[model samples]
Every structure is written in structure tokens, then in C-alpha cells.
Target chain A: MKIAVDAMGGDFAPRAIVEGVLLAASELPSDAQIVLIGREDSIREIFKEHNFESSVVEVVHAEEVIEMGEHPTKALSQKPNSSIGVGFKLLKEKAIDIFCSAGNTGAMHVGALFSIKAIEGILRPAIAGYVPQLDGSIAIMLDIGANADCKPEVLAQFGEIGSLYAQYTFQIERPRVALMNIGEEEQKGSLVAQATYPHLKANKRIHFIGNIEGKDLFTNKADVIVTDGFTGNILFKLGESLYEITKQRGIQDDFIDKTNYESIGGSPIIGVNGNVMIAHGISSPTAIKNMIGWAYKQVQANAYLHIAQALA
Target chain B: MKIAVDAMGGDFAPRAIVEGVLLAASELPSDAQIVLIGREDSIREIFKEHNFESSVVEVVHAEEVIEMGEHPTKALSQKPNSSIGVGFKLLKEKAIDIFCSAGNTGAMHVGALFSIKAIEGILRPAIAGYVPQLDGSIAIMLDIGANADCKPEVLAQFGEIGSLYAQYTFQIERPRVALMNIGEEEQKGSLVAQATYPHLKANKRIHFIGNIEGKDLFTNKADVIVTDGFTGNILFKLGESLYEITKQRGIQDDFIDKTNYESIGGSPIIGVNGNVMIAHGISSPTAIKNMIGWAYKQVQANAYLHIAQALA
Candidate 1:
């Protein structure tokens, strides 16, 4: 199996991406293969500078690069040879097992929907983020800013997707799922929440816990918290900002330390036909390395196969 | 002006409420009056225990009490003699300039809607929370769980109400208003955010800034952030949790310290016919005292009257 990295995707592309891929390449299993898709001349030059010229990693040269601000759909078609575009092409052609990019979020999302498409019978493929718990364990939340407006059926299906993630990715058996709402009662919150409560409770794929409030975010009460992308995105960014504050103030705690994005690697676009991870735009070399490492793990787990089967 | 206190409300009722009133009473203008509404016997007994028997405080006996978990509309009607009910009665009768309680949030919202009603032409009354900014100043965000569903017109009106609040309460002139969204672009986010953008931009009452994402929560991007109650409530509680993390870690930054809910007193229920502040459920005496203090400032600013005239 081959894992592809979009070396031209992030803010610190080429340098950070190349170094990160090399770092991941060193730590990965000897049988695992790495495919670097981007401008070949630059990546080769960097590999030579790092004195790893004989590295076994394969390089796939792409003629163009997508800017961080480019429109996802337009750029994907207009710049077919762009690293992100080429990476998607390789994944669709079965040349790469998974693709990872720290580039344009919209482009990654567009690629998941248009390039490879979602799993069959899936209403929508949502993005997932890692939420740190007070205990050593971390909970995974889904639909984080992908498909901002969700109907009752869509949110309920998130329960299924999130459950599969818990079982396969986090290795939590029979993950407990809860709806993110303003109040703990099933009847509280928005119309969408009130409408979605019964559907989630009736879902047989996962254990549905009652509603979880904001205070319950870092608690061990629930293994999976589900919500529409709008609310999920707000909570996701708020959590990110808190992590920034902790680091900025030079505060240290075991639980707080676990919320750092770099440590978690990246967020996955689940339910897509092929497995993919999108890193932060400003990610460091360590973060890129971690992203690659996690991508390899997901490939081993075959997250896409389980998701497609479950949805089917 | 008479300020009414619900002595039977909140987790630490009677004792905390009475103490907070006295703390405010001591510093209030000589002409300002405070009426403690609850079971008069218990309040006087606590006053005696605290050696404040000689204090010139007014007490209005209330025959019933509403527990924190009781349904809002049902509790308000069933217990007319409850502290919250009587407090609203006093306000409607023009006997109290303001009323405050760290009681059931839903009860307060119901009372605001039914007891006194909203200002004329108001679509719905919204509750506002004070968001601390990085520059030591704070912005006001509205519709934080009051009305779960809002039309575009209602949100546009919130920009106006929030602007008036910023100018009169926070003392910022012509406050910059913004719509909270999943993305910073005009075309991004949920349907509500997309629909509300044009309304806010066209509304003549506010200085409408464009979309603001989650990362700008603590920034100086906009002075008043407008969002549906569902999104706002999640962010509100998330902020509370972040502050809790800071306290637990013993992080000591001036800005981070300000995020403490206790220091900010309470959130105000805006767009109502009278001034009402709702403190945290487990508020300390200090938080209660600060709530009363801020209520006094709002009274001086005549926030409700200004909101009424602006809406008219």
C-alpha cells in the first residue's frame, strides 16, 4: 500500500512537508511505502540537503500548486497538475492507499465530495476532530464544519459514522454517543436538536447517551458527541483557541497538554470513498510527520472499508 | 429607583442573595432602594446571624419557591407568590427599576417574555453575554440560548439592540456589529448566517461588519457579535469551560483572568421591557454583588428605554 503526501499544500510546504514525510518515513514499518506528490525539483533538492538522497520514498512530480486561498472546485479542475489535484488523481487510480494535505481546507473537502466521492448509501461524509477528555482517553466528534446545515436524518447518521470511528480509530468498543446541546434534557435546545433526539436514541449501531452540555465537553460521560457542522465548528475552534491560551500563558497540565493539535496529527474526512487526512495550514514539521504516521495507521485499520460497509 | 432581588433563587439562596444585596446596598446611592423578595422570615434570620439586623433593608414576603429544575412557564404560573414571580410583578407595576436572580435560566427567559413582554416591534427578547477581549475591553454577544430559532429579520434587529447595548452599557460609540458564522466569507456558513448577512448589511441602525469566525471570539474584530441562540449558547458554555481550565492550571494572565464568570458578574437579558441580569447558578457572593452593580449602571444608562425607542 502507498500513502501520498501533498507536499505543496500547507503554508510551510516543501520544507516542512518534506522533512515531516522523511521523519515519518524513518519511523514507519519497513514494508510501508511513502509517495511524495508535488514539485519534484524542490523536494529532491531538500532531500539531498538533508543527506537522505538515497531515501526509498517515491516522488511524483506535479507541475503546479494550489494557493491556500484558491476556490476548491475551480482550482481542482483548472490546475489539474496542482499537487492537491494530482494527489486526488493518484488516490482515485488506486496508486495510493490514502492522501494527506495541510493545504486548502475547502479544496480537501471538495476533493472528498467530487474527486473520489462519498461511501455508497452515506447521506454525507463528515469531518472528525479529536476532543481531549479529563481522563487519559480522548473523544472524537464529527461533522465539524462539513455540511454546516444538517437535517435530522443527517445528524442521526453522524452517530453511526462517529461510532465506527470510535471502534476502529480510537479502539473504543460500543462507543457511547451523545448529542451536543445547550441542556442535558432531550427536549432542550434548537428545533433541529429536539427533532434529532429520538432518531439518535433509536439508532441500533451505537449506544446513545442523552444530551451533553458544554460543561460535559471534557468529561468521560460520553465517548462520541455528535452535532451539525455549524455548532461543531464553533466548539472545535473554541477548543483550539483554549489550547493556544494555555500555551501562550506557559501553563502546563496533563489534561490540557493533550488538547494540542500537533499531538493529534490531523482531522479525517470520513465516509469518503478513499481515506484522507487534512492537517492544519500552519502545521510544523512534527505535525506533518504525525499526520503521515496516523494516515498509515488508518490505512492499516482500513477505515474506509468499515465505513462503506456500515453505511451500505 | 428600587432594585428587586429574588432571595429564594440560585443554588446558595437566601444567604448568598441577602449578602450580595447588602454588599450592593452599602455602596449604592442613598436614594436607591433594594427590595428583598422571598420568605421574609429566613432572610431576616440570616441577617441576624450575619449581625446585619440593624441594616435598613426592605423585605417583601413571598409565599412559594420555585426549584431550579421546575418548568419555566409552569413554575411562573403555579407559583405566583414565588420570589421570581413577585419580582417580575414589582417590575411590571413600576415598583422596581431592575430585578436580578441567579435562578433557573429558562424561568428567567419565560418571565421576560410573558411577565413584562418585549419592547414594541421586537421579534423576540434575547439574552446577552459579555465576551472578554484580548485588549482588556469586552464585546457583547446576544441571543445566547434565549430563542432557539430566529428569522433573519430578528437577527438583524439583534445587531441594532446589541449596538445600543455597546454604546450605552459598554460605552463604545457606533459599535461594529458582526454575524457569527462557520467561515469568514459572506457566502459561507449555515442558512441562517447566509440569510442574516444581507439583512444586517441593509439595516440602517447598526454599523454592520461582515462575517466573523470562531477564532475572532477574543479578538478586536467586532464589538457586538450576533448569532442564533443555539450557536451562541454553545460558545458561551465553552468559554466557561476554558476559564475553568485556566483556573485549574493556575495560569495567571491578566486577560485570561478576566474570562472568569465571577468577575464579569452576570449576563443581561436584553430586548426586554425592563432591566434584568441573570447570574451564574452557583454564583459566589462576589458575583452576585457585581451583578447588582452592573444592573445599577444599566439603570443609569436606561438601556431598556433606549432599546424601546430605537425599535419604535
Candidate 2:
């Protein structure tokens, strides 16, 4: 299997990406191949310091880099030779099995949506992340900063996608899918949620588990929680901030500390046609390495195929 | 000043409400008075148990109660003699200086909107809460679960209300008001947020501090953070869950233990013409007592007058 890496994408690009690539290459199966996409000169310099074999890891030259601040669509169109653009192009052409980036998420999402495109029957792609709950359980929340304004139908689709992803990835059969709302009652919630609740209940594809409040998120009330991108993004950020604050508060608990961004590694962009992974822009060497490994596992599990089939 | 209490609203009911009313009557200045509204028999029985003789404490009879699960609007119309309905009516008639309830939030919001009415310049009433941050700071987040569908102008109004509330309640001058978005960039957020950004930036009423991500919520990045009701509710719930999870993990910090529903009292319903306090339905006796005291302070502070003046 071959994987494409956007070497020039994150805050600690090229160097960290190179180190992660080399680490992943060393530990990966003997038949695995890695392609690094970025500016050739910088990548070559980093590669020279490591003295790695050329057969296992190869570099593909790209002329430009998309800055984190650049507008995603304009940047991709203007800088087609950028590492992210080129890596996505490679994925579209099936040159690589998976495409990995720890770059600007907006740019990554835009690139994936227009390049790889959404899976058949999927309205919009969603980003799914595992949030550590109180009982050492993980809740899968989706559309964490994808499309902000979503219809009731879109949210129902998210429920289906989230349930399928949780079931396949976490190995939880009949994973409970709950819609996030202010209150647990079906009558409670915003207008969109009120409209979506009955639809989710009627759908046979997802295990609709009624409404789950944010307070139940940390508890094991549901395995997969679905929400619109606006709400999901807010919840994700709030959870992330809470973890950071608790860790910074000098509480030396291993469990809480282990749930940081580094521990979670990366989030998978579900509903895309191919396996696409997005890491935190500030990911370190260890995080990048884990993300690469995660991408490989997703490919091996054929998670994308299962998700497409479930949605279909 | 006279305060009206919904004696049969919360889980604790007449017992806690009666106790809170007596406590507030005893602790407040001699000029203060309390009117407990509920079924006369239950209110009288609760007051008899207290055996307190103060000219300040009185009971106003109401024949019905609104269940926690009942629809707010429908219940309000069907049960006009309910504790919440009668209390709000008393408030509307200028029979009480302030109205307090631990009833259903939707009922309180609906009752407050129609009965107490919105402030002159306010477009819609917003529910605001203080989210405790890491550095001994608090970020005031608004519209936690009020309006589901929101306009850009409504979000801008929330920013103004939140900023003013933070300034008056938390004593933060020149409070930074941030629009919650997926990213700090101006271009990143839902369409509503995007449209509101320029408006918030141009408005002189608030110290508009650009966009803040969910991760920035607990980092002291902004004193007042504004978002639509849907996203804000999700963020608030996530924060509440994190706080709960952190406490469960045995991180018994004073703030966490104190502020959990058991402590820190209730949330003041802002944007109303008068001071209307809403406590958690599952509030403890101590929380109920504290909420009464909080209501008394707001009445004394003339919170509504200050908010009106500031908005003006």
C-alpha cells in the first residue's frame, strides 16, 4: 500500500513530517511504500539528515506552499502545485491509498470536498473525532466544523454516518446514536432538532437512542452523538479547551492528561470517497507518527468502504 | 421591594422555595418583602413548618402547577393559575418587583418573553451563563438554549447583552466580546456568524474582539463570548459536562465542587424588562436559598435599569 504525506503542511512541517514519515516507514509492513509531497529541496535536506533508504520513502516535488491563513478555495486554485493540492490530486488519481495532512483544516476540508469528492449518497462530508468520556469510554461526534448551517435531513445523515463510523472503527455493534440537544426530551431542542428527531427514530440504518444532552456527553449514555457542524464544532472546542484547562490546572491525573490532542492523534474525515486524515496543526512528531499509523489502519480496515456501504 | 417566588416549580418544591423565601426575608434589608406563589394549602403548610414571623414573607395562592415535561407555551395557556403563570402575571401587574422560578426553562423563557416582556431595544431575550475558566476567570456565554434559529443581528445583540452583563456583574470594564466560530479568522464560521462579524466589528456598543474558537473559551481570551442559541447551548452543555467529568475524576477543586448545580446558585434571565431569575429544576435546598439571595441582590442593584441604561 502507498500513502501520500503533505510534508509542508503543519506548524512543524517538513521536519516533523519527515521524522514521522521515517518512523512510520521503519515500523510499517515491509511491502508498504511512502510518498512525501512538498518542496523538493527542503524535503531533501531533511531526508539527508536521516540517511534513510530511497526505496522505502520517496519525495515528490511541489513548487508552492499553502499558508494556514490563505483562503482554502482561492489558495488551492492559485497554488495547484502546493503540497496539499498535489497530495490530494495523487489520491484522486489513486496514486496513493490514503492522503494525510496536519495543515489548515479549512483548506484540507475544501480540498477533500472538491478533489476526492463526497461518497455516493452523501450530502456533505463530516469530520469525526473521539472524545474521552468519564468511564474511559469514547464518544464519536461528527461534523465537527464542516458545514455550519445544516438542515434536519443533513443532521439525520450525520447520525447515520456517525453510528456507522463508531460501529466499524470502535467495534461497537449496534452503537447508540443520539442527537445532541439542550434537553433529553424529544420535544426539546431547536427547530431543526425537533424536526430531525422523528426521522432519526424512524430510520432503520442508525440505532436512534433519543435525545442526549451535553451533560450526558461525558457519561456513557450514547456511543455516537450526532449534531450539526455549528453545534458539533462548539462542543468539540469546548471539550478540547476543558481538557487543556484541566491539564494546565496542575492536576496530575494520568487519565485526564492522556486525553490531550497528542493522545487522540488525528481525526478522520468521514464520507469522503477515499481515506483522508487531518491532524491538529500543532501536532508534534509523536502525534504525526500516530496519525500516519491511524491512516494506515483506516485503510487496512476498509473503514471508508464500510461507511459508504452503510450510507448507501 | 417585593419578590415573587414560584413556590411549586422545582423538584424541591414548596419546601425549598418556602425555605429560600424565609431565608431571603430574614437576611435582606427590612424594606424587602417576599411573596410565595403556589397552591395556598401547600404554601401555608411549608410556611407553618418554618414557624417564621416576619412582615416581609407572604403567600399568594395559585391553584395549579406546570410539570417539568409540559410544553411551555401550551402549558402556560392551559394552566394560567400555575405557579409560574401566576408569578409572571404578578410581575406583569407590578404586584412584585422581581419574579423567581426553578421551573422549566422553556416555560420561564416563554413566560418571561410574553409576561415581563423584552427590553425596549432588545430583539429577543437571551439566556446567559457564566462558564468558569482555568485562570480563575469566567467567560459569560449567552443564548445557551433560547432561540434555535438566529439572525446575524440577534447574535450581535447577544454580544451587546453579554458584554453589558459581564461589565455590570463581573465588573470587567472594556470587556472583550468575541463571536464564537470554528476558527479565529474572519472568514471562518456559519453564514450567520460571517454576516454578523462585520456588524459586531462596526458596533461601538460592544468592545468587539474578533472571533474566538471553542478552545479559546476557557483561556481568558474574551470576557464575553457570543454565539447563536444552538451553538451556544451545545458549548455550554459541553462545558457543563467537562466540569462534571473533571469532578468525577476526583479533581475536587473548590471552584468545580462549589459551582456544580449544588452551588453557584442560578442563572439570571437577562434582556427582560424586570429582574427574572431561573434556577435549575433539580436545584438543592442550598442552591434554592442562594438563588433567592441572588434575586434579591439583582432587585436591589436595579440590574434591569442598569442594563437598559447601558443599552440605551
Candidate 3:
């Protein structure tokens, strides 16, 4: 299996990506191949500085780096030879089994959708994240800003996708799926949520846990939580901010680990045709290393195949 | 001035309410009076336990109590002699300067709307809470689940209400008011937010700080944040859950201190005809005491008068 890494992306760019690739190369099985995409000279210099051999690590030179502020689709279109673009092209051509980037998330999502394409029946692909709950369990929140406007059927699809991801990723059997709403009552939410509740309740494929409030998010009410991209994105960001604020307030807990960027490493752009992992723009070297490892694990676990089969 | 207290409300009920009223009475000027509305037996038992004087606190016998599980409007109609109902009656008859409760929030909101009614020009009254940000500043977030289905005009009203509250409570001169949206761009948001943006921007009475994302909420990007009740309620509850999760995780900071129920006490229901303070149902003795003080401040400040002037 081969994996392509966008070495020029993220805050800790070339250095972190370089170190991560080397670390993965050392620990990965001999059958696994690694390719780093970035500027030729910088990649070479870093490779030499790390005293890494050229045999296990390969570099694909690219001239441009997509800025976080750039228009995602426009930048990807304009910069065809950019690290992100080239990396996705490699995955498209089957040159690599998977591609990973720690760069502009919007650009990553756009590039993944256009390059890899969505699954046959999927209306819209989603991004999922784990929010640590008080009971030492993780809540899997999906569509964390992938598609802003969603239909009731689309939300039901999210419930299926999110529940499967939680079952596979967190190893939870029969993951409980809850629709994020303002209140637990059937008549409590926006028009979309109200319409979606009945469908989720009737869906026999997944364990529908009914409506869960935002306050109950951290209380471990459900293993899998589903919502539209708009609300999901806001909730995801709000949860992230709250975690940071709490840590800043000197609240120390094991759940508030510094390994957030490192352990989770990156978010897999699920429902896409191929394996694609997008890391945070501000990820560190350790995080980058973990992302590469995560990509490899996903490939080994046949995540895409499972998702495709589940949807099928 | 006379304030009616729902002595048989909340987890601690008459005991905590009696203690809180006594503490508040001792701190206030000699002319201030309190009416503790509950069953005479329970009120007298609490008063006897505390060895409280009858001159400062008056007990109004109420035959019924509104249970947490009961429907607000239905319960009010069914049990007119309930403590909450009697308290509302006092406020309606202009016999009490203010009515405070730490009971069922929905019931309180329902009773307040039915009893006190919205102030003259107000289309819909909103619930506002102070969220402590990372910068040690509080952002007044409003319409946190009062009118879930709201219009742009309702959001603009929320902004106005929140702006006025921040100016008076936090004493910020010309507080910056921001509309919460997916992005800072003018074009990014639901139909309601997009329509409300231009009106808020044009309103000379408001500071109009533009659109802010969920990530910017805890950073104190704006002093007054407004949104439809649906989004506002989700955000408010998310903030609360974060505070709880972080506190449980042991993240200690001054911001966490501010988030404590004891410090923030109860939230003032804005746009109402009379002062109505709503404490958390799980409030402690300290929270009840602080709520009493907050109620006193609101009454003295003539919060309703200022709100009327601002909206006039």
C-alpha cells in the first residue's frame, strides 16, 4: 500500500511532515510505501538533515502552497500543481492507496469531493469528530460543516454514516445514534429536525436514540450524534473552543489530553471514493506522524469498503 | 419595594429561598420587603429553622406547587393557587415589584408571558445569559430558546435587548453587537441571519460588530451576540456543557469561576413588563442568595424601564 503526504501543508509544514513520514517509514511494514509531496529543494534538505535514506521515502516536487485564506475551489483549480492538488491527483490515478493533508480544511473538502467524488448513493459527504464526554466515552458528531443545507433524508443518511463510523472507529457495538436538537420533545426543533426525527425513528439499520440536546452532548447520552453540516459545524467548533477554554482555565483532566491534534491526527473525508485524511492546519510533527499512521490503519481496516458495504 | 419569591421551587426549595431572602433583606435598605409564596406550613417551618424575623419576610399561603414534569401553561390553568401562579398574580396586580423563581424554566417562561405579558412594543420576549469568554469578558447571548421559530426582525430585537443588557449589566460603553453566523462574510448564513445583518448594520442604536463564528464566541470578539432562539439556545447550552465538562475535567480558571452557578446566579428575562429573575432549578444556597441580589439590582436599575426606553 502507498500513501501520499502533502508535506507543504499545515502550520508545521515541511518539517513536521518530513519527520512524520520518516517515523511512519521506520515503524510501518516493509510492504507499505510513503511519498511526500512538496517543494523539491526543501524536501531534499530536510531529508538530508534527518539523515534519512532515499530508499524508503520518495519526494514529489510541487511549486505552490494553498493559503488558508484562499478560496478553496478557486485555489485548487488555479493551483493544479500545488501540493494538495498533486496529492489528490496521485490518489485519483491510483499511484497511492490514500492521500493526507494538514492544510486548509475547506480546500481539502472541496478537492476531495471533486477529485475522489462521492459514493454512488450518498447525497453529501460529511466530516466527523470525537468529543470526549464525562463518562470516558466519546461522542461521534458528524457533518461538522461539510454540507450547510441538508434535507431530512440527508440527515437520516448522516445517522447511518455516523453510527457506522463510531462502531468501526471507537469499536462500539450497536452505537446509539441521536439527532442533535434544541429539545428532546418531538415537536421541539427547527422544521428540518422535526421532519427528520420520524425517519430516524423508523430506520431499522441503525440504533436511533432519539433527540439529544446540546447540554446532554457531554453527558454520554449517545455514542453517535448526527446533524446537518451547519449546526454540526457550529457545535463542533463550539465544543473545540470550550475544550480549549477549559484547559486554559487550569482545569486538568486526562480527557483534556495535549494529544488532541496528535492522537486524532486528522479527520477522514468519509463517503468519498478513496481514502483521504485532512489534518488541522496548525498540527505539530507528532500530529502529522499520527495522521499518517491513522491513514494506514484506515486502509488496513478497509474503512472505505465497510462504508461502501454498509451503504450498499 | 416588595419582591415575591417562589419559596417551594427548585431542589432546595423553601429552605434555600427563605435563607436567601433573609440574607438579601439584611443587605437591602430598611424599606425593602419580600413575599415568600408557598404552603404556609413549609414556609413557617423554614422560617422557624432559621429563627428569621417576620417583619422582613411575609409568607403567602399557596395550595399547589408546579412540578417539573407538568406542562407550564396547562399547569398554570389547572392550579391557579400554585405558588408560581400566585407570584404571577402579585406581579400582574402591581402588588409585587418583582417575581423570582428557580423552578421549572418552561413553566416560569409560560407563566411570565401569560401573566406579565411582553412590554408594549416588544414582539417577543427573550431569555439572555452571560457567557464568560477566554478574555475574562462576558458576552450577553439572548433568545436562548424562547422563540425557536423567529424572524429577522425578532433577531434584531434580540440584538437590541442584548445590547441594552450588556451596557447596563457589564457597563460597557457602546458595546459591540455581533450576529452569530457560519462565517464573517455577509453572504454566509441562514435566511433569517442574512436578512437581519443589513438591518443590524444600519441601525444607529447598535454597534453592529458584523458576523462572528462559533470559534470566535469564547474569544470575546464581541460583547453582545444575537441569534435566533434555536441557534442561541444550542450555543448557550453548548457553553454550559463545556463549562460543566471542563470543571469536571478539573480545568481551573477565572472564566470557570464566572461560569459557576453561584457566581452568575439567575438569568433575567428581558422584554417583560416586570422584573423576573429565573435561577437554575439545581441552584444551591449561594446561587439563590446571588439571585436575590441580582433581582434587587434589576429592580433598582429599573431594567424594564431602560429596556422600554431603548426600544421606544
User: To one decimal, what is the Cα RMSD in angstroms of model 2 from the true structure?
Assistant: 2.8
Angstrom error of the Cα, residue B279, model 3: value is 2.2
lDDT of 1 by residue, B1-312 (tens): 777788888899978888888777778777677888999999988888877753346899998988899999999999999999998998888889888888888898898778788888988888898999877788988888888888988898889998998899888888999998888889888888899999999988889989988778887789999988988988887777666766766656677767778777788888889888888888888888888778878888877888899867
**What is the TM-score ranking, best to worst?**
1, 3, 2
Candidate 3: where is the Cα deviation over 4 Å? A19-31, A135-137, A246-251, A258-263, B22-31, B242-253
lDDT of 1 by residue, A125-224 (tens): 8888888887778787888888899998999988888888778877788899999998888889899999999999988778999898876788787888
Cα error of candidate 3 at position B297, Å: 1.9
Clashing pairs for model 3 are: A249-B252, A249-B253, A250-B252, A251-B250, A251-B251, A251-B252, A252-B250, A252-B251
Candidate 3 residue lDDT tens string, B124-241 = 9988877777777778778777777678888888888778777876778898999888778887777777888988988889899899888877788999888767777787777776
DockQ of each: 0.68, 0.66, 0.61
Put down candidate 2 lDDT per residue, A1-312, tens digits, no spaces: 887888998999979888888888877777678889998889888878988766888889998999887889999999999999998999999999888888878889999998989999998888887777767778888878777878888888888887877777777889999998877778878888999999899999888999988777667889888887777877776676555666566666766655677777788888888888888888787877777777776777657788778767
Where does candidate 2 chain B have its weakest 10-residue lDDT segment? B255-264
iRMSD values, candidates in order: 1.2, 1.5, 1.7
